[model samples]
Target: MISKKMADAINKHMNLELHSAHLYLSMSSCANALGLKGAATWFSVQYREEMAHFFKFYTYLIDQGENIELLAGKAVPNQYKTLLEMVEKTLVHEQLITKCINDLSEQAVKEKDHATQIFLQWFVTEQIEEENNDRDLIAKLKMVGDNGYGILMIDAEMGQRVFTPPPGTTVMI
Candidate 1:
């Protein structure tokens, strides 16, 4: 049986994952409004991925025989002064998420919950990839620095990204 403390933490993290989905969806809308359709598509895909992450947590909680608590999420920003600002915010948000995942991993270790620790390993690795991607985009955006043609090229490249569900997960994206 999962400890109460661990269960509560998972619940809280699950809600955060849901909040991330909303944040990305809002970002996608902002990109679309700015005429960056490619960036919009990229955010849309990211939104779906966040939803999948939320579901993964949900399923794990259920499998652990814990009751699920769906908490209301706070509103997310829907406007940005520029694409660079949006990407910068994304990186900041991703860094926060990485920290949260690390905290959860530490908690699992403290509780000696081997199963939970193993489960969180995926997220620990995922956070690394997430932060790296954000950093890469931030670097590109900085390099372009208010160049319209450059921004458009980046947007086109972003639009080429497609959502791929993590292997071995049955979560619908």
Candidate 2:
């Protein structure tokens, strides 16, 4: 049985994941406002991915016999001054998520909760990919440096991403 503290912590992470989905959805709106349809599409895909992640953990809580609650999220961020700035902000956010996952992993081990530790391993590795991808975008954005042609090229590339989780692969949280 998981401790109440562990359950609450998982719940909090689940809420944060949902909040992140909303945050990305808001970002997609901003991209639409700026008329970057391809970028908006990419953000939309990301938004959906975040929602899946949220549900994965939430369902895990339910499976484990924990009471679920709907938590309020902070307002969608609207502070980036430019598209590149927004991408940079995204990279930073992903890094923060990686840190949170690492902290949770450490806590699970310290509590002798092997199940959580196993569940967290997936997120830990996922974070690596997430951070690397964002950082790579930042690097490429810098190289392109507001060039319309480059941005469009990237926008086209991002548009190709489709949400297709593997069959029967649930978030074993």
Candidate 3:
């Protein structure tokens, strides 16, 4: 059985994941409004991934026989000065999420919930990749600076990104 503390934390985290998805979707809308298809595509993909993360937690809680308590949603800004600004914000947000995941891992250990600990291992590793990707995008955005050509090039490259669900995972359409 899942401990109350662990269950509460996971439930809260799941809601946060939903917030993350909303944030990303807003960013995608901003990109689309600015006619940056590539940036929009990238943010859309991130939005979908965030939704997947939410479902993962949701499923885990249900499978463990825990009641899910979804918290209230939070508002996120829908405007960005530029793609660079958007990516920078995303990196900062990702860093915050990484810290949150680490805290949850610590909680799992403190509660001696081996199952939760094992489950969180995936998220711990995922954060590393998440931060790395954000950093890489930040670097590219920095290099381009205010150059229109560079921005378009980056956008074109990002436009080719397609969402591919992880093996054995089913994503809602």
Candidate 4:
């Protein structure tokens, strides 16, 4: 059985994942409004991925026999000055998430919750990939600064991104 502290931590992170989905969905809308169709598609995929992550946590909590608590999340920002700005904010947000996950891992270690620690290792690896992706995108954006054609090319590439659940993720979306 999972400790109440660990369960509560997972619950809180689950809600953050939900908020992430909302944030990405909002970003997708903003991208559409900005005429960045490819970027919009990318953000839409991101939103779906976040939802999947949330469900994974939900299922884990249920399996642990913990009562889930759904809390209201603060509103997400709907407006971004530019695609670069949006992506920058995304990186910042992801960094925050990485920190949270690390904290949870630390807590699990303190509580001697081996299962939770093992579960969080996946997220630790995921955060590395996530941050690397953002950094790569940021570099690309910087390299193409104020270049319409370049931005469009990047958008097209981003459009090609499709959501694939991580291996061993059995939680159905």
Candidate 5:
């Protein structure tokens, strides 16, 4: 069993995950509106992955015999000044999420919840990959600045990204 404090923290994190998905969905819409179909696809795939993350936390809480509380999500903006701006914002948002996960892990450790610590390890690793991807894209965007052809090339590359769930994990898209 997890401590009440830990459970509450996890629940709040779950809400944040949902909000992340919403933010990505908004980004997808903005990309589509800007006629960047490939970028739109990328953001949509991210939206799905975030939803899968939310469910992971939700299932874990349920397995711990905790009552789930549904929280209302705040509004997500569907406009961006430029593709670079959108990606930069995404990187910043991901950094915030990484911090949140770290806080959760710290709480788990303080409470002496070994199970929770183990559970959070996956997220810790995921945040690494997530930040790395954003940084890589930022580098690419910086190289492609003001070049429509370069932007299209990056968009095509992002379009090829598919939602591949971890082995033995069933993620609903």
Candidate 6:
């Protein structure tokens, strides 16, 4: 069983994942309004991935008999001077999330919750991939530069992004 404090932290992280889905959806909407279909598609795909992440923890908490609270926060601004800027911010945000996951793992270890620690190990690895993917995408965007054609090419490339969550893990709740 997870400690109350650990359960609360997990629930809060679940909310962050949900917020990420919302934020990504908002970003996708902005990209669509701006006539960047590729960018919109990219964000939309990521939005779905974020939702998966949210539910992963959501179900976990429910199984643990902890309440998952709906979190409220300030709306994120989708406004950006450039697509590169948007990608840069995404990379930075991903890094922040990786750090959060690491900190949580450390806390779980300190709390002596073996199950929680094992569960968090999955996240620790996932965060590495998440950080690498964002960083690589940002690098690709940088290579594309600021030209209209370059942006279109990047858009075309990003449009191919489709998340396929692996099968076989036992889902909680």
lDDT of 4 by residue, 1-173 (tens): 79988999999999999999999999999999999999999899889888888888888898888989999899999999799999999999999999999999999999999998988898899889888988999999999999999999999999999989876557755
Off by over 4 Å in 2: 79-81, 166-173
**Over the stretch 1-173, how does candidate 5's per-residue lDDT look in tens digits?**
99899999999999999999999999999998888899999999999889989988988898899999989889998889778888999999999999999999999999999999999999999999999999999999999898999999999998998987653245576
List runs of model 6 lying over 4 Å from the truth: 166-173
Output the better candidate (1/2) by lDDT.
1
lDDT (CA) for every model shown? Answer: 0.92, 0.78, 0.89, 0.91, 0.91, 0.79
Clashing pairs in 5: none
Ranking by TM-score: 1, 5, 4, 3, 2, 6
Best by TM-score: 1
Candidate 5 accuracy as TM-score: 0.97
User: Which pairs of residues have clashing backbones in candidate 1?
Assistant: none
Model 2 C-alpha RMSD to native = 2.5
**Which residue runs does candidate 1 get wrong by more than 4 Å?**
none
Off by over 4 Å in 5: 167-171
Q: By lDDT, who's the top model here?
A: 1
How many collisions between residues are there in candidate 4? 0
Candidate 1 all-Cα RMSD: 0.8
lDDT of candidate 2 over 80-160, digit per residue (tens)? 455677678788888877787888888899899998898778788778887887788778878888798898777777778
Model 3: lDDT of residue 172: 76
What TM-score would every model get versus the actual structure?
0.98, 0.92, 0.96, 0.96, 0.97, 0.91
Q: How many clashes show up per model? A: 0, 0, 0, 0, 0, 0
Instruction: At residue 80, give the lDDT of candidate 5.
Output: 97
- The C-alpha local distance difference test score for the whole of candidate 3 amounts to 0.89
Model 3 clashes, total count: 0
